[model samples]
Target: MDKQLSPVELRHQIRSGEFSDQTSGLCPGYTQANLVILPKADAYDFLLFAQRNPKPCPILEVTDLGSKNLHTFASDVDIASDFPKYRVFKNGELVAEPTDVNDIWRDDLVSFLIGCSFSFEASLITAGIEVRHITAGTNVPMYNTNIPTKAAGKFHGNYVVSMRPIPQNQVVKAVTITERLPQVHGTPIQIDHPETIGITDINHPDYGDAVEIKDGEVPVFWACGVTPQAAIMASKPEFVITHAPGHMLVTDVKDVDLSDIL
Candidate 1:
């Protein structure tokens, strides 16, 4: 329950079953990650898909097949136990939502650490921009969009986007600030018009809870990390594992390091 714990300490808490809460605001200055675990047979295609669609699927680190450690991102980290929660998919269906995946770990599984928007949200808050979802105490609204991704091998799906309502005058400033962190899903993909991106109702979303857009505010969209989960479901892989939405893996890398990568 210590919000100021280092990424290593947070991971240790998760490993010891002491903390299993969503990792949204925890470890504030560190980078939080989306995780994807796939069998080696499908890894090459997934990696290529990520490479082709960097906006939604930025690669942070990829562990060797059968290895539980992601040495580049955190020292002595165990992929199976570091995250607060995990989702197990079988042939595209979610079979389990478990706190730990140790029992399900496989020798041929490859772990991919993906960049998450949580890293960028901190920057948005620092710039005096009001993140409506956070202010309203609700998960960010996410919608399936008409935006198409560049397919690689068996992976292909429409883009998934996260929404935030910004005032008309501040939209440009928001875009400029977020654009600097391209590793964490950059600027607004669509502004003011939800229908243009295939979102039928601004009050309803495909994932996460809806938040109110005030009288002078316009709903803005950003490419989301969940886009890959949609792609994996569409591709119907025989088996896959991903971190539960909003429940991310914290890494030792600072958000400033990600800015440096841009």
Candidate 2:
């Protein structure tokens, strides 16, 4: 469980069923992705959905229909098992949470690697800004907000966001640093205003653990990869697959070079 393990080595462990846990704190300097798999019938519309709602669905790579390999993320990535956990949705309801989807994967299945907030976390730390969830050893708190994303075809729903409590003074610095990584959810979408986004209770997050918001700290929200799942669920697509909350696909790309995909 070395946090510095290379992506290939870490992915091997995941494939072997040796590791099936949150990928957030691992491979700190590498880029991690949100997994989304859909059949070819739904792929085009979904891709259009992502393109319209780029912040929450910032796409890193989209695999061809029926293709099992994607070179954009890494040379040795297996969509079926590189992720520690996968959630299967049928008609929008999550039906199964599997460690690997090889048993059900089909040639018509298309996969997408969406940018995740974890990619910019290290930069925040280096900029003297604390990432609250990482400090608390828990997954970042996420919420489904009242904010709506632009609709594309059958894909239409509200945006989901991840929240991090920042000190009042360091908020601007945090924004400036994270804004540099546009491919991985750049900048705070809502700064210091939880109620503005319709989060009734910050302590009870819709996903992940809640961390304390210390004195003088304010809640900041960032566009999240979960936004797509929200749309998928609302649209009630016949079939869909995505990474379980908190778990993610580790990529061979380095964090410093994230802008290369931008």
Candidate 3:
């Protein structure tokens, strides 16, 4: 698959079932979103939660109830089918993982497009930083932190973070590159000390596989899009849908466009 495809083209491939893989490197220069679809009844509070915790839940666009088309992010994009994978949760438990959720579409559903770390990851790679997980061909390591997000209604939970191991020398440069993309979880929330953030063992991540931390490298952590999912599970809404881990919704907006506008 060509990783250089435009976001619209990638979404088309996803919608048509031509592509159904992790969107990490696809649509290289475009913004990729973390999707969260919930019942209209729960939309207000969820929006509030995102607003209060922008770092971990930076929202890009919110679709109206029952409307899957995100006019602000992409034209003619079908939320139900554009993402490569979907995680169906019922009363807080993940029930099934599906490639398409057309069978479960509802008129009362509200979709939210949250900014993802992939956008900033692109910036880091372009700046010549080695993203450890990408080099090792593994998912980035994520952990549930002790840091509590500001509560909104019943939506509340500890923050979840993604970690990347960087050489001590490159830490400053990585921070410099990522700091410019505030919409995409800007900068490292914590660096070097995993235990301070409640992460006991560096090798045992709560989500994704752990990559080696070289002798001169330190673990750098960033607020993750997964934080909202952790919040959703804690809240235990009657029904909720989210993009599967690493399977994000590609958007028409470019990373440079997002950075420039900000």
Candidate 4:
């Protein structure tokens, strides 16, 4: 697998079935997104839910019903085959994890691309912050917290968060750098206290790998794009689809393009 492929070329590989792997660290400077597809009947409620909670569900683009083309991301984008992997949900239970959504495509489905923290990982590495999971070649640790999202229609659930251990000295710098990328679930929602947020054992996470915390480092938590998946599971939506955890869509937009400070 070539790590330096451009977003266009990488997406092409995904579209052609030549590549099907987690997209983290693949397109280093490009933006990445989480995927969500739902029928038109549930579209308005989901859209309102996203708007009610922007930090965890920041909207990057929303395609029209019956269309998979995303105007702002790429002209040639194909939602069904663009991501390396997709998860299918029926009544909020995962029934299939496929490489593409070709067989399950529906005309009334609307696709949404939500901001992902992978867009900010490059910046974190550039600032000398150690993204332990990346260095360890593992998925970032994610957990479900007790924090409740504001109710929107029938969608209401706890927030999901991704964790990274930052060196004590670099914690402030991590916050300063990430806060600017608000469009991508910015900053540490919790810097040191895990128990305060209902996460008891940091070692066992609800999703992804558990990375080591070095001697002087403290765990930092950030709102995650997977919050929607949690909501889906909690509310038992009739039908929904999402990108598998860590398997994101590499967008044509550069990470810096989404940041005002850059």
In candidate 2, position 156 carries an lDDT of 93
Query: What is candidate 4's local distance difference test score?
Result: 0.88
Task: List lDDT for all candidates, in order.
Answer: 0.89, 0.87, 0.89, 0.88
List the candidates' TM-scores in order. 0.96, 0.94, 0.94, 0.94
- What is the C-alpha lDDT profile of model 2 across 1-262, one tens digit per residue? 7877899999999999999998867887888888889999989899999888888999899998787688777878788988899999888788999999999998889998898887788888888888888888888889989999999989898989999999999999988998898888888899976899889999999998899999999998999888887888888988888998778888888889878755
TM-score of 1: 0.96
Q: How many backbone clashes does candidate 4 have?
A: 0
Worst 10 residues of 1 by lDDT: 253-262
Instruction: Please list the residue runs of candidate 2 whose C-alpha ends up more than 4 Å from where it truly belongs after superposition.
Output: none
Candidate 1 lDDT tens digits, 78-106: 89998989999999899999999999889
Per-residue lDDT tens digits for candidate 3, residues 1-262, read 9877778888889999999998887767778888899999999999999999989998888998799787777897999999999999999899999999999999999999999888887788888888888889888899989999999998999899999988899999999898888899998899989899999988999999989998998999999988988898898899999999789988888888986644
Q: How accurate is candidate 1 locally (lDDT)?
A: 0.89
Minimal lDDT window, size 10, model 4: 253-262
Candidate 4 global TM-score = 0.94
TM-score of 3: 0.94
Native-vs-model 2 lDDT? 0.87
